[model samples]
Target chain A: MKSIKILERLLAAIPIMIGVAILVFLFVRLTPGDPVDLMMGSAGSVSQQEIQALQEEFDLDKPLHVQLYIFLKDVVRGDLGDSFTQREPVTDIIGRALPATIELAFGAAFFAVLFAIPIGVYSAVKQNSITDRLSMAFSFLGISMPAFWFGIILIIVFGVKLGWLPISGRLDYGFNFPSVTGLYLIDTVLARDWPALKNAVLHLILPSIALGMQLLAVLARVTRSSMLEVLRQDYVTLARAKGLREFIVIVKHALRNALIPTITVLGIQIGVLLGGNMIIETVFAWPGLGRLAVDSIFSRDFPLIQGVVMIYAFTYVIANLVVDVLYTYINPKITL
Target chain B: MLEIKNLAMAFETERGLVRAVNKVDLSVAEGEVMGIVGESGCGKSVTLLNILGLVPHPGKVLSGEIMFQGEDLLKKSKKEMRDIRGKDIAMIFQDPMTTLNPVFRIGEQIRESMRIHGLFKDVKGGFFKSARKHAEKDRAVELMEEVGIPSPETRYHNFPHEFSGGMQQRALIAIGLSCKPKLLLADEPTTALDVTIQAQILALMQKINQEHGAGIILVTHDLGVAAEFCHKIAVMYAGRIVEQGRTEQVMDNPHHPYTQGLLRSIPKMSSKKDRIEPIPGGVPDLAELKEECAFYPRCAKAHDKCLSQEVPMFDAGEGHTVRCYLYG
Candidate 1:
């Protein structure tokens, strides 16, 4: 029954994906810059014949409808076309960059959840205490502060000032390790390379923190308020009356009920992170899909841009689906 | 088995310190069923919570010694109180729909009390912890059966939402009886249930009391329920018990004006009166309560002395007592 529901949801994503593809195809074209102009702008002397020939080479001279039709036709056959700038297959580029973004996202999500739940539960349990007030204040700052700016500050303090960590990139330039998973963290672990794993972790800390700060803040506040409401419920009082330890009451009884809302925020955050943290990726100079998308946008690489957007849309659909499934586990009352 | 002496609980609200339960004195012996009846906010539920040491935050025990079994519950540390709760003294809350955690299976919740207190810890299962767990589960199923829940085996796996209101209450009773506590504190356990269901739940509780010999302190607003279910009745008004005695004695010969008004308010089936006389005026504001009788304004027998001084409980006869100037 659950699988059938999931299948129906998957089927529903088809039209949405097509709609996104159409919108992205048109929207990218609607942008001011032409790919031919962008590619030839750097060349000092460029003639109309050279531009026309380049346009013809990329099949960009075709009418908008004809181009859309060709693009849709090729997409139906599992082809995303090639990037206008890199002249590489869009799928190949995305596949290569995807693992990097996933690694960063995993790290950020890990950091967010690790700190958010405890902070939220504690603040709720000791409501109006000094610790609650201080944590809440910090969370407010976290939610409001810009991730890019925070990323910069972290780089300056941890990288430039203290010089305790690498300032940019995922790993040291000279340290060559075979890329098994492309996610350096896991690849290093799989290879039993401790030095590489340590280096990967060190590089991950600042970017992950900078990216995860806002999510952590939002999650903590949500968890705290949700927990506060749950704790006041009759069941909590009853759980206490049942002689269950405070820990069991809070964790097993209270936390599970409280997590429903937190899971919602977490799901949306995960979707956003998976879509790619464009600014954070740029700041850290991380080789992730967000950076790829940003570069493609600048170069008017329409196919690459469309591909990234499609992946993002797909990720959001899957994230929401996972959240819905998780709801059934967290609260039996909520049917899938 | 349980004796609460001068138990006064106050909630620190935004307005001020509002006395919720003031100078409440009550006791329940082994196998006795005591009912504390009052309108909403009269602190009947608070007194029950006070006994279990589960009064919510901002509600402080102003001055009290809830002596249970022999020791004062108020003097017990939080950890000690937890050990006593559900093991020696279990509580069945009102609104079964919300009392049981919705996420957990009904059987898991029923077994939770035993698991917490390690009821089957002595089971001989060296390197086989599943044997102890199995014993616990079997006991939970037995409790479910004892509470009259249909098909204890399958229903045990169902969540709270799956159960009907009556079934939920039954499950809650099952949870209360799981640990076989010496005392049970039922806070309006059947208030949310329908009339028929209420009677069934009450009967189930009475049976549990008879079989297990656990003393019960039931808090309720229904006078009829108190009359039918309790051996001893304590009627509360404005956070204080105005009258208490054997159920039949209080029912037949009420002393307090508030108690008389309450008795008059109950629609009698055999009476020719078209309308029951409701006690006029709402309960007094606890925060602004003066040193006079809290029910003075609403009392038909109010006098100069009733307004001038605080009233004390006067012995009427037998174990009967009433807090009124007329008695004084």
Candidate 2:
């Protein structure tokens, strides 16, 4: 039964990767730049002679399919090619950036779930009260205001005005924690450096908040509405009629049923996290794949752009697979 | 051993007040099965719910008290009510589909209240004594045995859905008997079963009465079923009991016009009761029936006195009471 579900989930992941490849391929072609312009420049300063030589050398002079085939071939061989601007391999740049982005995602997810579920549960349980109304109001505000604006407001208030912490950047000037693993939290803890750990967490705070606030609202509201519906099921009344305490009735009986719908909604919200990386990565100047993709798009760097989009697609497909497995865990009906 | 005094109930809905149960005074002797028989909307179920404290919210028991073993139930707090609810008084509800939790096994659901009320008293100091735990399981197994379940020991792990209708009722009976409650409020308990199962269940109830000596308040819409099972029968119409008497007396000498209609409606085996006339017209809405006996509109014997006010109970015979102007 478990294996069949896993097989379905594995099958479901294929389409997203196909979508990512298709989108990157078409969009890369749609944007007006070849490897010639990327290798040289748009201005007459580079001269036509140099641009022609560069295009031929990089196999950009070939047909679209051939160029695509060559790119795919190199990609399979772990060749991300060189970044003309950075004067380094695009692979190295993304490899360095991916860890920081992963750390932020984890930190944001932890805080959002921790804050949202309890608030949602409490609001649902205490419904129509001041706490419920206030929590709802906050959710609206979180979802409405743009992440960049929220990020800016957080920086102005906590960073510039109070002079408590740095406004941007991931770490202090000279503090070097050895990157045993790429995540800041793990490395900071390993180096036995409390202050770097503190600053790293602090730096992630505003951007993660800006990125995660919308999801928190979405998750909490979905949870509250779902719980309110589940509360009316006959099983819940039966549990109450069983002479169980109110806490047990709400927690054990109502919440478990409520979580099934909430899991589907949470999965969608987490999937939307990739969109946040676009705005958040640029705002904080955090070195991550989102910034790399944005930068690559502007330069029309095919290899780098394809790789970055693939990561987002890969993470998203895997998140959905995890959600399916999670649904099975919460409700046994979904199994084979 | 049970006396229900002047029970009144009203449901506060978005519309005005809807009277559900009203000023019902009833008594049940030790081991006697008293049935409140009525058509739907006659408040038969609500009166039993008022006795069991299972009436849904927004439907309030507006006045009166229920005295069980000479102690009034309305005075007890919700916590104290819990102590009496499933322990001292257990109920087998009408819909077998919903009475048991779908998620839990039959044995666990049945054993829950027993372990709550009976066995835990010995292990109250935050520690489980081996003998107390042993006794809890022993008593639960005995209850399943008493209910005549096939292979009670092996069937302990099965869920409610796994049981057939008759088996489910037996499981419910097992749960009801687990705490050895003083009163069993069975609201149409066998109404959902087939004829054969109904007979078996009725027989089981009689066996339970013989063995345990607990007062059983059986509610059913079927007059014949009531006559067969109950020691005393109360004929309710439009939220009031129009006639009540010992089963033999009520069956043989029904006085109220509505009772006469109901008795005649039953296709009886008795020779004199051959010409069956189905009761004409439906039960009048209790909430809309203003300033008169609720059943008067349909009562063939209703007069000017019936229109003026509600009829009070009049003694007709030995332990017989009929609420009608003709009887008065």
Candidate 3:
């Protein structure tokens, strides 16, 4: 039965993926700039004949339906088409950049959850105490600030004023390191370059913080309310009556049940984090899919935009699917 | 085995400190079943929760001496109270559906209470961890069997949601009895069950009381169930025990007006009254407490003097007591 449900989810993702592909493909064309001008490096700089030749070279002269049909056909053949901007295949660009995005997004989510859950649980247990009030106040402040703005403020404080860290970018460009898996942190370790690894980590810290802080607030608030609700549950009271330690009662009994709803929210937050990364990556000059997608959009790289958007959509669907599967493990009462 | 003297518990609400339990005095001898009967919010549950140190926030035990086996439980530290709970004193709540953790197997939950008390620590005169685990599992199965669960070995793996409501209560009862507590406090143990299930649960509690010799404090609103299962009854009104005595004495001759009102309200099979007599007026709000008797506003026998003076418990014959001006 569970396998059937999983199969159904996989089947459901197909139409959604197709819908996303069609939308991104159509939307990229509606934008003002033309890829011909971008490829030529300026508008009207190249002769009409050269522009026409270039259009023919990439099949940009073809009608929308024919282009979409070719795109879909190529996608089926495991090809995302070549980048109209980068002069490399879209797949190769994604392969090189996807890990950095994954690391940033997952790292941000990991940081958010690690701190938010404990803060939430403690706030709930101590409802009106000073710590609860202060954390809640800070969460409100966090919610109010846009992530990109926060990223800039972090840059000002740590990057410029204190001069404690790099102002922007994923690494010190002068350093040479192995490119295993295209994720600098892992690649540095594989190369056994400790200094480069340290440089990569320091560069990642600001961007991850900017991306994670908003999510942390949201997760903490959700967790706090969820925990408060679960703490009042009769089972928690029963745990207390059983002479279980206060810590066990709050953490094991209450927080375990509390995490179900928090996990659901966290799943949605993953999608939010992916979207927020675009702005954050732009500010920090982080090399990730968000940065690549935005750059592709500005360059009118239709195939690249569509490719990146499709990947984002697929990731979101999978994240939600994972959360649904986790519900069963967390609470046996939930069958699926 | 247990005694509560001059217990006053209060909750700080917007209105004021709402006194929940007002200078209440009660006791239960070893192997005895003491029933505390009252309407909802009459402090029956609060009294028991206070004894368990499970009273929620903003509700403070203002002053009290809870003497259990010569130790004043109110004086014990949080750690000391934890040691006493589950091992020396166990509680079964009203709704079994809500009380049992839904995620855990019934056997694990039963074992958890005993595990907290380290029941399996000295297993077979050796502290082998695996041996202790095996013994606890076996004991959990035994508890399941003792509570009349059929095929205990097989049912031990079932979650609380898998069990029927009656069975969940039985599983909870098994947990309560797991550590072999000297005192068992049950708050409306059968209120959520059907009549037959209620009877079965009551019978099971009776068996536990007799077989294990655990003193039981049965708190319920149902006088009928109390009469059937309890040796003595304490009738509460407005957060105070208005009358208490041997169950037969209280049932045969209810002295306090509120107690009489309660007795009159119970539908009788023998009598053919067209309408049951409900006690007039709702209970007074605890916030606006006056020096005079709280029952004065609702009492059918309230006099001018009853409105002005405080009422005190006046001893009647045969260990019976009534808090009323008539008795005073």
Candidate 4:
């Protein structure tokens, strides 16, 4: 039964992916700049015939309907075409940058969950205390501050001023570690190079914090409110009446019910973390998909932009699917 | 088994401090079923919560001595109180629908208290932890069967929502009886249930009392239920016990005007009276209560002297007491 439900959900995503494809295809075309003109404009003066030839070569000369048809056809056949500027297959470029983005996104999520839950639960349990007030104030500050601005502040304080961490790139220069999975941290661990692993972790700390600040703040507030509400539930009272320790009452009885809403927020925030990391990636000079996307947009690389967006849409669908599946496990009353 | 002396609890409300339970004193011997009868807002539930020290925030025990097995529960630390709760004195709440956690299976919740108090820790020593777990499950199933639930083995895996309201109450009672507590405090355990189910739950409680020999303090507004199930009855009015005695003594030969009014309010089968007589007024606001009789405004037999001084418990008959100026 569960498998059938999951399969149905996966089948329903097809139309959504197709809709994204059509929208992205038309939206990229509607933009002011033409990829052919931009590519040739930088090469000094060129003839109209030469421009027409380049346009035809890239299939930009076709009518909008015909172009959409061809694009959809190629997408179905697993072909994303070549970037107009980089002149490489869009899939190959995405493959190279995909690992870095996945690494950063998961790192930020890890940091957020590690700190947010405890902070949220503590604030709720000790509501209105000094620590609770202070943590809430900090979370408020985190939410109000922009990710890029936080990233710059972190760079200034931790990178330029104290020289405590690296400011740019995945690792310091001349650190040779075999790329097993393309994620520097995992690769370092796989190679069992402790110094490289340490350096990789140091590089990750600042960007992950900056990228995850808003998510952590939002998650903490959601967890706090959810927990506060669940603590008033009769089951929690019953648990306490059953002589369970306060810790067990809060964690075993209350936290699981509270996590239902928190998990929903987490699912939505992960999509935001992936899409909104563009500016943070640029600020931190991290070699990830967000930076690649920014570069592709500036050069009017339609295939590259389209490819990146499709991946993002696919990720969102999968994230929501995982959340729906998680509901069944967390609450028996909820079916797939 | 349990004794309460001068126990008072106050809540900080928007208007002012409301003493929810005031100077309430009662006692119950082992295996005895004591019923605290009162209307809504008369502090019956608060008095029960006070016994377990489980009152919600903004309300606190003002002054009290809850002696259980010769030790004042009020003097126990929070940890000590926790140790005593569920292990020595377990409590069941009103709404069975909301009392059990929805996410967990029935048997797991029943096993939780045993797990908390480490009930069977010495059976096979620490090494056979899995063996101890098996024993706990077996005991939980035994409890489920004892509570009159059908097919205990299969029902153990079901969640609270899967069970009917009566079955949920049974599961809750199973949890209450898991550790075999010496005293059970039930606050309107059958108010949310239908008449037949109410009778069934009360029968189950009576059985638990008879078999386990655990004292029970039941809070209810239905005098019929109290008369049917309890050995002694304490009638509360505005946070004070107005009359208390043997159930037959209080029900048949009630002394206080409030007790007489309560009895008259119950609809009878043989009496040709068209309508039952309801007490004239609602319970007085507990916050504004003065030293005079709280039932004075509602009592049909009120006199001037009843308002002149505070009324205290006066001996009405053998092992019976009534709080009234007339009795004084």
Q: Which stretches of candidate 1 lie over 4 Å from their true place?
A: A42-44, A47-49, B126-128
| Model 3 lDDT tens row, A144-253 | 99898999999999999999988677789788976878888899999999999999888888888899998899999999999999988889988998999999998888
Top-DockQ candidate index: 1
- Cα lDDT tens digits for candidate 4, B139-254: 99999999999999999999999999999999999999988899999999999999999999999999999999999999999999999999999999999999999999999898
Candidate 4 chain B: minimum summed lDDT over ten consecutive residues — where?
B121-130
True contacts kept of each: 0.87, 0.09, 0.76, 0.78
The true-versus-predicted C-alpha distance at residue B7 of model 4, in Å, is 1.2
The Cα local distance difference test for each model comes to 0.91, 0.78, 0.90, 0.91
- Candidate 1 chain A lowest-lDDT run of ten: A167-176
Which tens-of-lDDT digit does each residue in B132-210 have in candidate 3?
8788999999999999999999999998889999999999999999999999999999999999999999999999999
Q: Which sequence of candidate numbers ranks them by DockQ, best first? A: 1, 4, 3, 2
iRMSD for every model: 0.7, 3.0, 0.8, 0.7
Q: For model 3, what is the alpha-carbon lDDT of residue B109?
A: 93
- Give each prediction's DockQ, rounded to 2 decimals: 0.87, 0.28, 0.80, 0.85
Candidate closer to the true structure by DockQ (higher is better), 1 or 4: 1
| Docking model 3 quality class | high
- Candidate 1 lDDT over residue span B260-299, tens digit each: 8989999989999999999999988999987689998887
Q: Which candidate model has the greater TM-score, 1 or 4?
A: 1
TM-score of each: 0.97, 0.83, 0.95, 0.96
Pairs in steric clash, model 2: none
